[model samples]
Target: MRSLAYVAISVQLFVGLQCQSLPAKVKKCHYGDGKCLVESANALLRNFPKGIPEVNLKPFNVLPVRDWLLVNDSQVGGAWYFFELLNQINYGFENTTITEIRGFDKDPTATRIEIHGKIPRLVYKGDYLAKGRMLWFVDINSHGTSESDFLNFRFDLTLKVRIEYRNNKRYLKIYELVPNIRLDRWIMWLDNFFPDNEDLTIAINNLFNRNWVEFWNELEPGILSLFETVFLSLFEDLFEKVPYDDLFLADEDSK
Candidate 1:
């Protein structure tokens, strides 16, 4: 695919705020893949095709949203939902709730990471929810010995998060984001025309799923360019209803 160009869309014009100041290396996450988008009823619906949803400048300056992610629904006081994070996301719950984690059921440390955030995982301890009209924070305090580089670092960070109901999924820049469920089906349909070569099936599936990263890497530059244009476009369409936002993470465990 073409390298993401030096594209710079104004936050105020497109998103309407500079929630946080981000480092140059950070790239914003759009509303697709890797789980974690929000379910805001018609909030996303109003933003696409029919019209642009009004930006909630209430939390006006959230910047550097890292990855797509949402606190597990079970812990969000109700239904199942997710938030998107760009990279890895870490959470730090409030101490007041440290002894009273009533919102979440399982212990954060003990719960199994089903898909490493590709799937829903509870957000219990190290983070705060963006509900009830108050600003919440997620803290990242890590130590790299001074002998290595600058001073040890620790600080509070803010991120954009959303609650997305599976039934209520939506996306920005897209109207519908149902996965290319037909891609595999199409391959199978085409396969019927080919002989029943089990080896070919295995090879193609492997090429498309497991090794596709490398496979994509080897595509002619021109082909890759076209592929990304079509691929990201499709993704945006399929998942258009999910609430979209960018998040920033100082480190993996801090997301």
Candidate 2:
């Protein structure tokens, strides 16, 4: 029954999209700025290779960010290059201005890679691919979204490369749950029907807390950041010193 209902609703949405004209060519994302999803993804992949590894010949983003560091192995700023790759890869819906760039020219530390720019988009918490095996070696996502013309046309897609290095050799492959998705119809359906569905909202919120504490711990550490930290304090470690002592008058007679 539920499956049939979903099919019915989905059909209605598709038909509605086909009938209504998309009013504009802009949409804002949690990442801020107004640009269609497909366009932003395209911008990211297209520029991935520009200032990448030393040679920049890889022409793909399959390697773990760490492994991609090797491409710049022969020069300084190799580690920074690794970060640059991520910056481009995670480009959310933001302006074309420089966001943030912090790293050593030749050497940098992991604890603090350094960051610049106003990164407003919350990182997509869940749905990471398999670790050792590069499933999304070649990610091709299409968004049939229309910011201007709403004739149910427009394709914004991206192709990302993934690879693994073993025994000093490289292996490459593609990964996807569904290789092809008709996002135009999907987004329209989601926008109208599930935008405020309680169950769906709960599911997305669950992902937010799934690793929430762990992420906070990474920012501040020690005995204070234990798994029990939630009970001990709500971000107590990050609190600034109160310095209430200064507020008191030296002449205890004011009382």
lDDT by residue for model 2 (1-255), tens: 999999999988755433322112222122211233334334544465232232122333221112111112222321211101111122122222223323211111212222222212311111111111113232212111111111222222122223334333223222211111111221101111123355753453455346544533442222122212211121121111111111122243332
Per-model TM-score versus the true fold:
0.18, 0.18
Superposition-based RMSD of candidate 1 using all C-alpha atoms, in angstroms:
25.8
Give me candidate 1's TM-score against the actual structure.
0.18
lDDT for model 1, please: 0.25
